[model samples]
Target: MVLPNLNWRAFIRSQPINIMSRSFAAIFAGYLVAATGSGLLALIIPLPASQSVLIAMMLSFSFYVAAAIWAFSVGTSRQAWRDLLLISAILYIFILWVS
Candidate 1:
């Protein structure tokens, strides 16, 4: 059988699509923040190299969870995207500065 044509406008405006967008922000953006935060910590912590790396990795788990919370707690998916992307940009810039 032939496949039906997809309605791009309806798909874009649907509630589930909105939720999916927010969920993507939560999982992937959260991961980006966590990874960037870990790298920053690894550079900045004053411990021995190995110890600082370990501590940074351990502490990054909290960053991941907090980012997920931040993504969902916002009023809208667009706001979620805005806030998370802004945070990711800031963290990445700091990483560059620290390096």
Candidate 2:
């Protein structure tokens, strides 16, 4: 009896481009949003400087988680990038304006 040869290459496949783009946006763009948003928050919060910074740092985590979830949950990776980048840009502009 002869054993049939199996093609292993057929079983392997690369990740879809959308997934990679979304992952990139989730990690990098998300961080941008969180960092800039935190900076802006730190500047504007009414508490003492130190306490405001602490509060912003804590809120930054929520922003990051929300960004990551949003990246994956959106209908398209393009939308995710647009939203995160837009928010990051707005936060950055606010930070510059405030301080």
Candidate 3:
């Protein structure tokens, strides 16, 4: 019986850092952006605060799902991070400006 040898180093080396970074951003940072943006939107919308919060809570998951999809769909990890950060920053700035 012949046993196949696994080259762990080669496998590790084959994985790109950008992909890992992107995955991290998708899983963690993306969620943060979505949640923050949703909360900010909830605050800024014309609806009553209570209603807005309720709606925002309901819709936050959708934003997270969409962000995850976008993170993976982009051409590169850097682009994904950049887009997510840019969007988050813009939303945050808008929130600050509105308040």
Candidate 4:
């Protein structure tokens, strides 16, 4: 049996943006959303501080994963960046209002 070799060079060449740039955007946006959401949740929830923090930490991972997925799923690099920025801005505004 023969195993197929992955061609990273070809994959990179075919993408609208370089893989590194895409990955960096995804990771950065994901973390920003996660952190902002966690902080907002911690402040707004009625539970004790420790429990709220714990719950925020647990739920933040899902936000991060979802943001990362959205970043990569968009049609173009520009759209991905724009969408992330827009979402982050909205979240920031909500956080400000809640605090």
Candidate 5:
């Protein structure tokens, strides 16, 4: 059996967050969602280490935001959008507290 190789870095760079796409509406929406989420948590959660957990939470949560924006832009239903946002919020909280 033959398997196709995947280039993960290339795939990731193609995402909305990449600098070249920063002005794209979807990318902007993802950033807005991520920033809003981070701000809310920063208000509720006590600050901790700056380098590791905090940064990781920001990065991962941003990706979740990007994925969500992509999903909604592709005509995902309102229910799906709600579910994805809820799941991402939960995941962000879990990561913030556990890490």
Candidate 6:
């Protein structure tokens, strides 16, 4: 059996933008979908919802800000931005789930 050795450094340098763009798009799209869905749920599912209009707006803003940061962070610290997006998304979901 032959094992392939993947060189991460070379891979990272070879397609920085590709990785960043895909990460950014995925994060952005995922957040947008969640936010939109939350908005719809907020309207439809009424039951002492913890998410107020102000909170929802804030979350929406945070998603946009994260995406803008992700765009700028590319070619500089793609990994850091990628982690940020992931963490933010997770936090958003956690909040939605808990609250």
Note each model's CA RMSD in angstroms.
Answer: 2.4, 6.7, 5.7, 7.7, 14.2, 6.7
Which of the two candidates, 4 or 5, achieves a greater TM-score against the reference? 4
Lowest summed lDDT window (length 10), candidate 4:
13-22
- Rank list by TM-score: 1, 2, 4, 3, 6, 5
Q: Give Cα-based local distance difference scores for all models.
A: 0.90, 0.91, 0.81, 0.82, 0.54, 0.58
**lDDT tens string, model 3, 3-74?**
689787665545476678778878886887887878797987789999998888888888888888888889
Q: Flag the better candidate by lDDT, 1 or 4.
A: 1
The best candidate by TM-score is 1
In candidate 1, list every pair of residues with a backbone clash: none
Backbone atom clashes (below 3 Å) for every candidate? 0, 0, 0, 0, 0, 0
Tens digit of per-residue lDDT, candidate 4, span 1-99? 996897877776575545555677689977888888888888888999999999999999999899888877887666777887788788889999987
The C-alpha TM-scores of every prediction are: 0.84, 0.80, 0.77, 0.78, 0.34, 0.38
Against the true structure, candidate 3 has what lDDT? 0.81
Q: Better model by lDDT, 2 or 6? A: 2
lDDT of 2 at 79: 93
Error of 6 at 63 (Å): 3.6
lDDT of 6 by residue, 22-98 (tens): 56655665465447645644554445656555565556665556655555565555555555556556655765675
Model 2, range 30-49, lDDT digits (tens) per residue?
Answer: 99999998999999999999
- lDDT (Cα, 0-100) at 60 in candidate 3: 84
lDDT of 5 by residue, 1-99 (tens): 886897877865664534334334344445545664554455456557454447646665766566555655553343444545565567567657755
